[model samples]
Target: MTKSEKTQIIESLTIEFKESNAIAVCDYKGLSVKDLESFRVAVRPLGIKVQVVKNTLASIALKNAGADGLEFRDTNIFIWGEDQISLAKAISKFAENSAGKFVIKMGFFEGNVVDTKHIELVSKMPSRDELLGMLLSVWTGPARYFVTALDNLRKQKEEN
Candidate 1:
């Protein structure tokens, strides 16, 4: 586009990347527009943003945002969000279903540059909500068993 437009985009993206918890650079070479749209829809609810940006602009933006060490090349689609776990999970799941058409090249997570394997590991980790739910279950387990045991004891005493 025009120089002004490019400048505006760079400014906005710099701000966005600065606020992001993680950014995944994916190679979406063989995927269709429809596939990309559906992927966008799927991750929108998770607060992830999907975009196909010029590599140079993206690199500048990332560098301006204080993230470095990533080199973008060849048809990259950027997937980013404020939640690293969700971003990793969503992109990894999409990559799994893409059948080699889409690939996870590398990522910037929490100030560190990571690879596909590292992204996969982050994806497999429990989300904040899932971790909270597991914690709640564990915390209430003993109380629940105690109540059940007390009820059973009362029933047996009444029978006697």
Candidate 2:
């Protein structure tokens, strides 16, 4: 590739890194084009992007965005999204389902480096929307209980 093309790629990736909340790298060494494309489609709806990029360019982009420590090696497919959990879940699920073909390298979660164990933990975490729903439930739980208790008391008084 020419220098200008490489520069453009690096600039674009740097912008992506700055915009994303998390980034995960995986080795898509043996994956077929169709499989990769299908994976991309599955993740796109979740706002995750899957890109097959050259290691050196990725490294430069990552460094420019102030995220370092990722090892860009053979057949690396970079994955990222606006939130950490979604990207982590997608990558962890894909890697697990791939039966070791798509080996996960590591990740940058909330500006920190994450290993395999952390990635697994992140995959199990509920998405932001789910967490918000849970919080809403928690917030309304006591009020609901109070209203039910009042209704039952009113019924008992009417019976008496």
Q: Flag regions of model 1 displaced more than 4 Å.
A: none
Score each candidate by Cα lDDT.
Answer: 0.95, 0.91
Q: What is the C-alpha RMSD of each candidate to the true structure, in Å?
A: 0.8, 1.5
Q: Which candidate's TM-score is highest?
A: 1
> lDDT of model 1 at residue 97?
95
The TM-score between candidate 2 and the true structure equals 0.91
Q: Write the per-residue lDDT of candidate 2 for residues 1-160, one digit (tens) a residue.
A: 9999999999999999999998998898888899899899999999898898898999999999999888766788889889888888888888888878898889998899999789989889999999999999999999999999999999999999
TM-score on alpha carbons, each prediction:
0.97, 0.91
TM-score attained by model 1: 0.97
> Model 1, 1-160: lDDT tens per residue?
9999999999999999999999999999989999999999999999999999999999999999999999976899988899999999999899899999999999999999999999999999999999999999999999999999999999999999
| Residue 2 alpha-carbon offset, candidate 1, angstroms | 0.8
